[model samples]
Target: MIRRILISCGIAFVTLVANAAPDDSIKVVKGQVSDYYITVTHERIVKGRVLDKNHQPLEGATVMFFASPMHSTTARDGSFAIKGADNDIHLYVYYPGKKIVNKILALDENNLDIVMEDEAHKATAVRRPAQATRWYDPQAPLSRTFCNPVNISYNFEPFNNNVRPNGSFRSSADPMAVEYKGEYFLFSTNQGGFHYSKNLVDWEFVPASFQRKPTDDDQCAPAAYVSGDTLFYTGSTYEGLAVWYSTHPKTGRFKRAIEKNVLPSWDPCLFLDDDGRLYLYYGSSNEYPLKAVELDRNDFYPVSKIHDVMMLRPEEHGWERFGMNNDDEVTLRPFTEGAYMTKHNGKYYFQYGAPGTEFKVYADGVYVSDSPLGPFTYQKHNPMSYKPGGYVQGSGHGGTFCDVKGNYWHVSTCMLSLKYKFERRIGLYPVAFDGDGVMYSSSAFGDYPNWAEPMDIKKPADRFTGWMLLSYQKPVEVSSIDSIYTAANLTDESMRTYWAARSGNPGEWAQVDLGAVKTVRAIQLNFYDHKATQHNRAMDIYHQYRVYASEDGKSWTLVVDKSDSDKDCPHDYIELSEPLRTRYLKYENVHMPTGHVAMSGFRVFGNGDGDAPQTVKGLTVKRDKKDRRSAFISWQPDTDAYGYNIYYGIAPDKMYNAITVLGQTEYDFRGLDADTEYYFTIEALNENGRSPLCKTLKY
Candidate 1:
């Protein structure tokens, strides 16, 4: 049987006051009986005074009524009055210096008095999933001092600050740092070379034991595993994997034991089993498939036994993917890269990097299995993090480690300096597990249990305030409907609009000449694929169409009604119709409506005379001398019309026979061959109508 238990704040205080005079008796008014009511009641004359921690009355305290729809504010005397009805009500009292009070009460007595205290918990101390972690010392003075600068795109950036006096190479990603005997040693890999560090942070260049080998200088990512005095590291030298062993790790020199050239791999990591066998698990990228090989404790090479772990394949999961086939264009499709394994509480946590380990998809996730080699289950609430704008892009290369306190932490590289576009900085975050032992990234030091913050509701007009257009989905042509329109509202103007006209023909841009209107501030183009329209797909699923406006119709500005949108865009058309105003507004364009096409419902708003425009006639058309099949044409725009139009014909006598009207000043006709003669002419159209044809010339 499944049961849902509700936890309630059990603290309550009741206050009732009785005055001597009859006139002072509590006044109760029977308000209009309705389904909804506020916490404060009229007849009860619920008046109250609130004080702060020091017992001083707080001015401008916001007393909120939850579950109910009504609330009132404290006046100069820290007093408020409310007309409430009997209901399950929770009062949330808030002020600048006082702690927030959430009180649940059933109305009985008339008079109410309350006092609030200073909250010990500060707002800034609130832990978030993206911020929770031991590495993030919220109270630490040096919390924001460091920066992350690493490019996870190529998936290879060395860590550790181990530096040499010559300053040959940089290494701040020191994951395999251990102190043997009296000296400390660090291991790092970037691109295809190896580096080491005496200290954990500072790093120095070292001769790569596998670099000088007789190959084309291509090396795969590396992972180091140290047990007792024997140091083991995996290296990919051009072909397959080559395991290197070294006793003099401090000297950074190693000797190869066995090189297996079969499976394609990178970022090879070594793990030891209870039976004393070594397991090699590595992959191409966090998005690629990961393979595993069993190494004999005797030789550290493949003992003729191999295993492959299917952690993740981009196509299997619903997340974004990248890297394409044949061509070099990067897609949102998945390509696995970083793969690390950790054992905790009898469970093996297999982590994989995905999408963009930074900028776009700046988070990491983990899978768990009871046995180290069995099938694993992926965490549901993954993306494990929400990284806002920061230097923490591609932050998923380092491994997870346990601190001295037995707490878990994750250290990875964050691309801090994009200057190289390839190098990145290393950073650390804390990892916490739920009751089920699922690894998750934390934005704070502790796990948040059953806590959810209320989202603030915003008005439509209020939403577009101070908005700016930083970028568009793609560059657009004047014809295709899918264009992006954006705006920046600096003046805070509430209402602005533009006008449009429905072309008599469907699926056409009906020209609306804003007659004599010089400047246009705002515009709106009505897209009616509604029930009355013919288009069904657009009407059924809802897509956007194109609508543009201009200062001078001749130099028109493009506006898209709906182009860029996630499946769950917070603001949709339903919200727009609910009384919204804005200074700058653009119609985002989308594909043509599915079932219906629009030809009517043209509208115009803003400060302008909505009327017909004048037409211009004088224009010229000429065929290209090089390729007679091509034609070049120019036309004079009408001053009153704010734009012009043009047409052409293949026969000289039928100059205006075949016409293709254009908006801009020039038009280029393609697909013509050399030494061919073509005849063309021009005409101007506006709100008034199409004008007479002008000069026609042949090449």
Candidate 2:
């Protein structure tokens, strides 16, 4: 039956058979179809209209209909409908906001009209999801499905402030992002203070007085090298492959001269040879093979004495070991850590991050060479294509920068989930090069682009590389505010449907416009948690969140909270304090304001008065079991509805419930004991009744 339904839909069974007749004015039958067929099918009804490079019609445009048994999808107007007996087909059209269409169908036809063209949203500009804005029509006929591997969106800075890699410091690969002049430093080794970005989606934290720690405790090999005023680094200490020197290379201040095992075999890299010598590649990985020394053109150090070179592994070349057969256990068993070498134009690529490290369909690889050390050559289409969120499972220690207009970039670091503990994160991709220099990784970059590289307003100090002009950030004036602060009206959608009608919410809370400040400090609540919200608050509202600082926006102050209340909040951030100077600020709503409150955007650096915002009402709790120690609460008649609260606790207690739970979900008490501890809380009832108090959980 069509090769047993393409082997039970894992698809991929090519064998098309030929036929003549059934043709009554439509001919397109080109053979190949076996594996016991006898079903008399007669498919072929493709239609299409996925457009953007100005062609129009692209409503969810995702059509696919590869032939060889079958595979289909295409609706929302870009219609499709395959049946399959075999008449010829091969159409894969995916329009993730535009662009991605491959066709070559020849099925006797009924009415075909495909036209898809979105060349990467015309170079990056497609950020739509407020229900996708509408409009689709440029002559329709679209329908087909089964092909989606293009949802790529770039602009990364997913925080990997490492140092949390535990037990003898397990492992945390490299991240090395650099933009120098205009800002974007990122350097990684899992974490050691250093994340500054001017706009790669806002990143901050360069404290530890700008960190460069040369010892006093070392691990370092998250590599950083600056060139021009010299600032090269390497780390793996007890004092070993150490190497640190900074004539203020971008100014983080360094000076740890150990020179002796310059490559104590870690992740150091520093090439700058065009006759000036300074090659230092290191590696105890990529199956141990990457070594080089040569340095010293006046204190670049290590003048030669490292050796090793070559051995990035994998490639007996012959069906590259046939998919190497993944009976599927997610498969992964080949190694080779990060190896870096780049040379553009004179050609010498050689990137790495391969085989094992939590396999995601065999990780990254690239190779080519003219000489950085020798004999590179892989890339007959090496393992380059498997990026489930570029940061999935310990990506390899990667590095490659080039942006003075030579435009080549690649910074890797993966592990946002690889099952085996340690959630490593950090990603940035976009490296093209193929004229034999080999390097291709374009996860769709047709629009909405910005990974830094476009701020040379006539050399604004070359974007201030290694930055050092720090001055402009002072401006917080909301009409000399003394404080009348009520705040919390968030552009009202009935107060976000009244806090999304509570229960496990995702709505309500609006009072933002903090565009003038003098001293209100922190407040960032761009919250969102409704993947099935409903656990009664405080698991740190789905793991972690706390950044409350208010000067009258309604009595509050918790300032940048994160005593690790469990862990799992991440959605990017910027809640500040220690540098206040505000006009007013508000965004108090620590995790899960109820259950599923969604807010995709909200900024308030200080200053308000945009008016309207001050309602706050959502509480309804009920529980009655009086005597085990307490229980007997009643509620359910909210005038303008806002009166009823209760929260209980006990079980790995940190402190769960303490009064503040009125208008009944039932609550009464008197030391009983089978277990002993218990907790519950709630409060908010007004228009002349109950207020003040809120808590939830206990069992």
lDDT of 1: 0.41
Model 1 ranges with Cα > 4 A deviation? 1-186, 191-209, 213-219, 259-263, 285-288, 303-306, 311-320, 323-332, 356-362, 384-388, 403-407, 416-421, 443-699
TM-score of 1: 0.36
Q: Each candidate: what lDDT?
A: 0.41, 0.41
Model 2 segments beyond 4 Å from truth?
A: 1-173, 177-179, 187-268, 271-276, 284-290, 295-415, 418-423, 426-570, 576-699
| Model 2 agreement with the true structure over 1-699: per-residue lDDT tens digits | 121223323444444334533432222222333343334455445544444565555565556556454544555655565554455566666656445667666655545656765454555334331111011111221111100110111111122332213211122346666666655566665343455554444444442222234222223445666666555666543245545666544445666666555345566666676655667666645335666677674655676666665554333321111121212223332445556777778877766665444433234566776877666666554344223221122234567776565565566654432212333444454465544444655322111122244432222112211211011122222211112221222222111111221322211233433334343322323333223322211223233333443445666544444423332333333323234543334332334523344432333322222222223234333233442322344444333322233333333222222222223333342211223344444444322223444444344
lDDT value, residue 302 of candidate 1: 65
Error of 2 at 391 (Å): 18
Relative to the unseen true structure, what is the C-alpha lDDT of residue 356 in candidate 2, on a scale of 0 to 100? 42
TM-score of 2: 0.25
Q: What's the C-alpha lDDT at position 344 in model 1?
A: 76
Alpha carbon lDDT at 50, candidate 2: 48
Q: Count the backbone clashes (under 3 Å) in each candidate.
A: 88, 93
